[model samples]
Target chain A: MPKKSSSTKNLRSALRIDPEDGVVDLADYSPRKITTGPDSRKASLAALEDLGAELVDLQTRLYADGVAGEQRSVLLVLQGMDTSGKSGVIDHVVGLVGPEGTHIRAFKKPTEEERAHDFLWRIKRELPGPGMIGVFDRSHYEDVLVTVVHDQIDDAERLRRYRTINEFEAGLVAAGTTVIKCFLNISYDEQRERLLARLDDETKNWKFNVDDITERRMWPEYQKAYAEALAATSTEVAPWYAIPSDRKWYRNWAVGVLLRDTLRDLDPRYPKTDLDIPQLKRRLAPPN
Target chain B: MPKKSSSTKNLRSALRIDPEDGVVDLADYSPRKITTGPDSRKASLAALEDLGAELVDLQTRLYADGVAGEQRSVLLVLQGMDTSGKSGVIDHVVGLVGPEGTHIRAFKKPTEEERAHDFLWRIKRELPGPGMIGVFDRSHYEDVLVTVVHDQIDDAERLRRYRTINEFEAGLVAAGTTVIKCFLNISYDEQRERLLARLDDETKNWKFNVDDITERRMWPEYQKAYAEALAATSTEVAPWYAIPSDRKWYRNWAVGVLLRDTLRDLDPRYPKTDLDIPQLKRRLAPPN
Candidate 1:
């Protein structure tokens, strides 16, 4: 077993939005704020080296505990604008752990079959089994975010969906899934810069979605939709954390810290042996 | 882009079982053989650090290509007795690439639902999509190995399944999935030592199955089953590689090299864009 790396840092509370805080005002949150953990890019990267090791240990324990029949699991839901580095978190942060234990699903445009069902139908199919870390690149929240920004859903339906989401998450929490949702918040300027960078880099051309510019035109509408959706759905059991993500290093480290802390709190032990060790040891001897 | 680490070493050919060679004699193969790549444990570890960077690059390209509609993927099928370190390869080998691009499934015994269908029915369900790396810990081969040894299947049935597996693999290859099968072969003495070590360690007790002792008692039967299976199914399109796995470091590094080389061979490229760059850039500007 690796030596555990514990810290007093409470990234969870530092970044969490309280239910009473009500609708989040996008302007109040800085895209460059370092609320906890490392304050500089270099330090965050350096700290990640140690953090990665600690995460691997915790993740392994979680997987081990699950293999021994523990039913609990962790789910991380990452929601962000195109350039907010959602995929970056999966690569640099979750990349630190063993792939076998991490179940990742990047929700794309709804397929014909998917569109036929309720929003949570597809999401429910992909939930991680016991002891796994489930990551949603974009999640059921997209049903609210994208649809609302485009005015596809009416107020009555949108409000009803929020209530449905809350009930759904509450069920998940009751069934032993610790859900961590993060809204990777970046400034409008950051999105423009990232999109431009993709345009300039020929290698990144495939990632440049033309619709991103079309969406940028509705920036204000998106902010309104996001703020309202986050506020309504953020509950005590599954609150939303607004991560300032202009700095890629900070965003990656912050998510890594959140995962590490959650796994640490769960404190999944290597399960006790059900087998008779002595008898098994004797049986294991080579034939004479 | 990091400079590619090209090597003359063909670990694939060095380790692959030739179909024309007929049945493999386990005694003729050394469990600690290092046919290619780093010969020393420390050197293999160091090489893995560099290999990991190469793999991450290749895996990223493969994923990007898939995103751009390229339809090619890799499947690695791993089979061995307990304590042969199948999970170790997952952690130390496949873990080098990003989790988003790798799909790992460790097949336990067939559930009631799995048994109701054809053997390949469940296996087919887990096939990796475009640009993903699929790994099966104990795969379709188990039907031949375990059932045959336990007298559940006759010789005629075992041979028929081999033909079915070959055709299934040929179909997968035809559909752009490269299949690599590895039989992690370890000596009886090595298995004994490893089992004893597991029994000694309290933390690893969860991994120590009492059934492993029962399996070990039927070691010769398993060897016969494995050798015959490898011989019958090893084909030009999908060959079985008998990996010498007594040394955990060698086994891990060997599998890593297999994945790295396979990805390097595919050489997936970041896709070209369909959007007009200048027009998009102009539209990306914020309102004055």
Candidate 2:
């Protein structure tokens, strides 16, 4: 079960990957592990619904703080392979929050204009304003993962991009933004089942891209790329959390827990108005 | 009562302001009117919940159409006075739909750069791509309403803006967009109660703006401005519907119904795949 927030254990830490702990290994983490979520699907779904109500409150408070000129915001970066539920998490998890204060961006293949600029150019453009929760379906981390796996960039370039990303995140942290990077870790076999499921369901056929199969063929190479990239860029300011994704319910539950805890820690307050309340109330008493 | 969809009444027409019918006289409509929603608050709330589940399915199908390269999209433009519940409708109504397929843009005052360009420039930039639902808290109509009300432009200039806006919306329709403009019809007393309530509640204090009072003081001017603008712009291409807004429950229920009916009318189909399904399924027979 997703442990109660009041519990002595720090549940957020359970998902975090601290590179200093060891060489980050993807093989060690089971994609189906129900580390923080309820074991049963029925209870897990209930837990998630309960969490959604709490998340909405926390998120709106953060938004209210921004309205009072608070600079802090949260950025939840979602990274994963095809069918690993990046969009699914966004729909099921972040969708729980009101869109008024939630900003979502799903990055696509770089346009010629975007490619002409630096890798972070388009990303910088889409950053959520103060008090908003920004969910990135894919992020600048793609630079360190996809290109490197495809042989478009060498180790030296990848290393430089890593440094650039760290500095970029550091700047964001200094500007009062908290970054939560979630790596949705889905297993190869589980992915095959998902892709096949899409093919079997006619309504889901639009989601079945031929490129997904091509990308899955390079799963081992992509896994190595992600393991290295996650290790390289998972900074203290913005650490990467590898979310087990073979079980969709568990993955959503875990991500929800991460967000709820992060917002609670921030604990944004409703701004105390300096306006003379009684005087305003008196003024408003007159009928138009 | 919010009549069932199967009824022969064509309830959507009751809310819509057809320009050919007559000039939209705001005096004829009651802010507390329960024209197209259930009479009792409890029933309307329950009805809204029921409508939500059906709306979600319709919205996703529209999204699926976009994934299959369809060009159609829906834009719901919300306009009203202070505390007319624009954001509330989004949180309560549109929030039921997944954020993946829904795009929301809340326009604040134009910055220095925005004022430097044509009024429609920023609006055009934020138009939803294919198979999306776009909600505008305030929209291009503001040029004709707010600025005109404040007398920033002469009558001729106001007429020019109305023409420009109509052309712009026409362009959008020609490009396969269905525009649903809703003028949330909240009363002067309702605005006073809402603003006072915001100040009375600690958490809602952040939403209490001094500017809201200044604008609320101009309720009469704003209403007249809205009436004229709605009549001018509520055309064959994209008509404006005056939604009774004193009852928050009815306001949300009405908007939800508007969206559901529009999508159902459009009847977006899931895209059919041309890929060789059998061969791909067979190729997936070999596991790595």
Evaluate residue A22 in candidate 1 and report its C-alpha lDDT on the 0 to 100 scale: 68
Candidate 1 CAPRI category:
medium
Judge candidate 1 at residue B180 and give its lDDT. 90
- What digit string (tens of lDDT, one per residue) describes model 1 on residues B157-215? 99899999999999999999999998898888899999898889887777777778889
Which parts of model 1 are misplaced by more than 4 Å? A1-8, B1-8
Candidate 1 chain B weakest ten by summed lDDT: B1-10
Residues A89-189, candidate 1, lDDT per residue (tens digit)?
A: 99899888878788888899999999999999999988988888999999999999999988899999999999999999999989989999999999999
Model 1: chain A TM-score against the true structure = 0.95
Q: What is the lDDT of residue A171 in candidate 1?
A: 94
Candidate 2 local lDDT, A196-277, one digit each (tens):
9999998899889898888888989999999888888888899888888999988988898888889989998777779889
Fraction of true contacts reproduced, model 2? 0.81
Error of 1 at B15 (Å): 1.0
Candidate 2's DockQ = 0.74
